[model samples]
Target: MIIRILFLFTYLLFSAQLFAQVIRYNTVDFSGMAPFWQVESSLIKDTEPDPDEWNALFDAPPYQILMAGGFSQKEFEQQLRLAFMPSMGSLLRKELDKNNPKSNFLRHVMQIMGNEKKLKELQANLQKAQLIKTALSMAKELLPDSFLYARALPPVSFIICDKAISHAPTGVIIDLLFSMDFEAYVPYFIAHEAYHFYRAKIKVPNLPGHNQPEYPIIQMLTQMETEGIADQIDKKKFFLNRGPFAGYEWARSYQHYLAKSPQAILQLDEYFIRMATVPNSDSKIIEDLLPMNGHPTGYYMANAIIEKMGKRTLIQQTANPFAFIRLYQRVALKDKKHYPPFSSITMQYLRKLEQKYYLPKKAEQPKQKSSPKLMWYEKDKVINNW
Candidate 1:
């Protein structure tokens, strides 16, 4: 028994050291959630709340990090206050506020409070150090083998909170209450959100300012590439494993959108053509047409690259969106029937933009007058579409 216990202790110590090298969970941020939830529950139940505990949550690392990272204080406070008085119509100040009792915010609060047993269960499960290690292990497995080689994955903290919306801006802020809905699939989300921080590390070349017409295209390109590659990290693995989420509604919907990725790509091609041919075209219409912030569409592109050129090529192109576009163009041409290739005009415009932006800033270039013999499309105005 003594030998077995020593072996187990040694094993756990080594495992923890290994996990720490890859990813670090912010235990300080996670530790605050349970206390906040308790105080929130007391307030919801009309019981006397601990003022000190309530105040402490606001000062906690999770709350402070979000506020420091530009998350609106009003919005953060509102999310917390909703649990205290969800039905008070006067409290709903924002036009975007979904005050319906069945709204996601209220619904999550209802779920969290209505099932004390489940909430406690989830809190215990989510706080486990093993869960982070396992989730990150799954994440590394899902990502392209050379994905991490392109750039260092940005440091990110995992924050647990009551807000239904989960996002990775500076840190990955997860909703403890809303996450209960995912149940066993929460690890999948953890992997997905963590990939975004990795995606953000890929630097964009110096490009047009926001006021320039090219700015919107740059935005669209970055959005698609970032979310597109990251989506595969989770969505592909989720389907492959299926686990308990095989018949889940959210899972079904996610797959449903993924199936429409082909159509989404064709739609984006049409938008790019307009931007290439027409002057001053922005990405708003394309944004409206794309599903789930260009995840499915971008996934289609990334998957196509992997299928035709191989994952290593796709991984190599991950750091450069311009290179990613060129690679996608190559793949689309190889299988024209399935993936519609971007037009020559669009390709030309993209190549020119890439060259102009990526040129060394220190090397001065002499601007020349447009040659009289140059074709209309070859001219600066047509190329820039400004």
Candidate 2:
């Protein structure tokens, strides 16, 4: 027992050092999430905190994601009401009230910070970051060069989310509240979200206007494509092991639906085809229409596209996502039998999309042409579409 304990301690000590070098721990963004939550929850009860701190926080990298993500105090509160455990919400606020003896805002912030949990996650993310960086560094010159390589390493922020996780154009946010082995699958989650961040930097044209028939379909496709790229990045490009993501294990729990076919997997999205195209259709209408009986339609289409294209092309597709759709269409031409029925639906609308957005008439194009980004995740509303 004594020898085992000693060995475990040494292993942990070495692991900690390895993490520090692979990816630097960034607390600035996460630390702000707490105070920002206080500001939102009335926990601190000081809506009138110093203007300077507010301005600085809004300006800060850690907090800049809020604005970049289009999340406001009102929307965040709504999410909190929906996402947070009710007991914890009430308890945390009461503990943080000014009259409480233990109401040090910073101290209370630590409660939800998940410091120890985050530290373990830090190790996982570091290993992932190292893998990604090493692969990119080794293959940077060998691979096709693009604007993605020109960008700096995106900062990672750990926080509590009602949802499992999300990434913004600015950074990746991993939630500690999902109640799982935050470390086991964190590498994949980080890589997945990081790819979202990376793709956001790419200057693709926005999907067709909301009223356009093509809008919702493309939005769904782009999400799946983004997920596909993230999935492939860690799995194929870097060749990293899943380690402990529990995805396969979770898949095992559903014995009722064994080995679902691609065609069936995509049929789920077809339920929303009309609803998504309708002007001002409620988002909830399509929410129930997730594919694979549970996975989003994006997951299925993205996998099909990625499997057909392979890694090298997929890497290039990050800079030009239109290529994914175009390439998928070409594959459909050659192998029409395997694609889902929705492939036909997309093929019908894609021509209009390419005409309206990608190949607009000269009169329709912008003057001082800044490339349009795929603004699906942070569309017209303050909410995150993903």
Candidate 3:
């Protein structure tokens, strides 16, 4: 028994050493955020992140992005309360100021619910900067002119985003930089965001200025263009880390579904286009999106764009979302043999946009403080499409 125990211990240590690449990460956010999650507690049993669990997570859809449907079993409903509003910096400051064990919202979730394990895992993993370095290296190799390589990877401040990883890298946010369960694939996530940052800095023609939001359909197409290009860039490197299996699985499954039948996704695309360009596309369609969980799944469009454009051309249109959607139609129209017949209406709409003419905006979106602020092309319509 003693010998067996020793062997297991040795193997575990050896495995960790073998996988621990020497890399560094900007801890400004990691450090800032760690203390809030690292507090001591007695009500929790520590559970470690399983590197093997991402596939299972992907098997259930919401976990792919929203981290929903009990996919994590750890970070779902209970976790959402932890981040309903943007509170990372404020949260840390509050914790420090109060210093009272009773005052921390995270403590209630951690100790009271036995989820301190997830928090601890996040704290422990951020110290391993090698993964960050790996993510950056992969991005640079593929797109040598990446924002990360050009200006160096930015400081990533980790925060809980309801219950999933997302890139909201505006001003100083890093959108929950690393999750323990998904740590190995941190680079893939980084590379995706790196492209968004890079693409944002790029000035392309006919897009709205920073001060003004682009039309909803145009915004939808832009998201597809940028995200599709980012996927093309970061996807090549994920096999090495085995981190983004769920994400890749999602993209593949979406593409497969579209190949077989595209009615549903195309419905979403048409809805968005009408919202943006057609004066008569009923704004009431906004209510229909509530069923979708978080606006239409732009990732579907992202997959379609990548599928239609091929890797080389998709990469080339990273900054030009307008061109990206146009190319998707161009490719789809060219491949009529493999694809289902296009709705003549869709075909006609494509022609209008291709001719650089789009329907005039109908009624503009109504503004209200009660409603959550929305990005271009959508209000807080769905729960999962992020």
Candidate 4:
């Protein structure tokens, strides 16, 4: 009995050590400055505390107060387990459902745990899995070659928090959020946002006579257009590596199937499409349209635009982000296709303007002369011409 007790105690000690090691951030070293794991202690406190220090998991009262001061390693780990594990499990189950003949269950199991040890092993194995590396590599290639920095905003994820989803500006921040077991839908979400950041850096031409109040609506439309471009790039890369019917489209179709059968798997495509075109509609329109967490239509419209742009190179010369909006408008007008609810009225207005201004006119030359000449008798020439 004494020997058995000793063995059990040793086992417990080993397990605790392993868990502690797993909780430590191992991706990037930040040892001397401050432990990356110590969220609150490292935060700059003042009249307004640093948002990065804020604990997303402490959704309740006293725990929220505890989080405000910052949490210990043990407390943070507990919060992570409580807040993330179940959601991660759900995501894992969904991924499993889409498993192909080549899918490895053990590999996905390790991803779910996401421990430092497991991550190292996964990285090593990914190096060996040439096919997956190629696929992911292709996806990376489609992204714009620029990094974006938003001054001091805390990293956020697309997870449903208090009935809303938020995104951060940087990919590194996004990767960290994903590490915390946030549900990842489309891989392009990070890449798409990054494109927006890139667009912001360059001077884009403004819409003539466009009102400032309409900026939000136009900005969302621009995001939709860029997202559509990225989607096409992703699709092409995915198809080239994995073959048609193997990549994002397959995942998208599978998601659609799940959404239809299980109301819980809500799709955001319709929501974003509406948001891009209709900013002033009653708030209840969204609630009525997608009773579940007001489906993010912005994200959806981005996806739709990507689908339309196909696999062409991204146009860097265009001044406006939604330069394609004009093209889409022209196509829709010419074809007489149904415009999305948000765009319907806008399109109608554009059509009227196009008819008013876009008309044919014959060019005429000056009656005096085609070439410059010093006319000594300009009075006589003018009188004769008149």
User: Top model by lDDT, which number?
Assistant: 1
Name the candidate, 2 or 3, with the larger lDDT value. 2
Q: Write the per-residue lDDT of candidate 3 for residues 1-386, one digit (tens) a residue.
A: 00001001111112221111221223334432432332211112233223343234233221222232123445432333333223444654465467453234344333323445655566566655664566566555435254444444544445542323433322122334224445655566665555555566665455444443234445555555554456555443442134344245444543444343445445655765674467576544543442222212334445555576655565565555445555665656777554333455655564555445333346788786596766866744554565
RMSD (Å) per prediction: 13.7, 17.5, 20.3, 15.6
Q: Among these predicted structures, which one has the highest TM-score?
A: 1
Which of the two candidates, 3 or 4, achieves a greater TM-score against the reference?
3
Model 2 segments more than 4 A misplaced: 1-144, 159-166, 175-180, 205-207, 211-213, 234-243, 247-261, 264-296, 305-309, 315-323, 329-348, 360-386
Q: Mind giving the per-residue lDDT tens digits that candidate 1 earns over 1-386?
A: 00001001111112223223434443313645656677666667655556676667666555655554454655545555655555643553442266453244444454455666776677777666455555566556435565544643322333344343434343345556555665555666666665665555545668789887677677777778777776676666554236454455555655677778777666766777787788667656766766666666778788888888887777766656678888998988888988778778778877877787754557677989876786766788776885
Instruction: Please provide, for model 4 over 140-242, each residue's C-alpha lDDT reduced to its tens digit, 9 standing for 90 to 100.
Output: 4544333223221122222111111223222112222232332222233334434444445544433323454444444444454554444443433332235
lDDT of 1: 0.59
Model 3 lDDT at residue 202 = 60
Per-residue lDDT of 1-386 in model 2, one digit per residue for the tens? Answer: 00001001111112223222433443213444444544434423323445554454354444344444454544444333322344456665665565442344223234443344564455455434553454344334223466446555455555543234554434455554332334444454454544554456666465567786555655655655565445443433222233333244333322123234354435533644544365355543433444433322334445566577665655665544356666666655666687644455545555555566655366665578776775776565545444
Give the candidates in order of lDDT, highest first: 1, 2, 3, 4
Residue 54 CA displacement from its true place in model 3, Å? 34
Model 1 residue runs over 4 Å out of place are: 1-28, 40-45, 66-104, 135-162, 239-257, 282-285, 359-386
Clashes of each: 0, 0, 8, 7
In model 1, the clashing pairs are none
TM-scores of all predicted structures: 0.69, 0.49, 0.49, 0.38
Ten-residue segment with the worst summed lDDT in candidate 3?
1-10
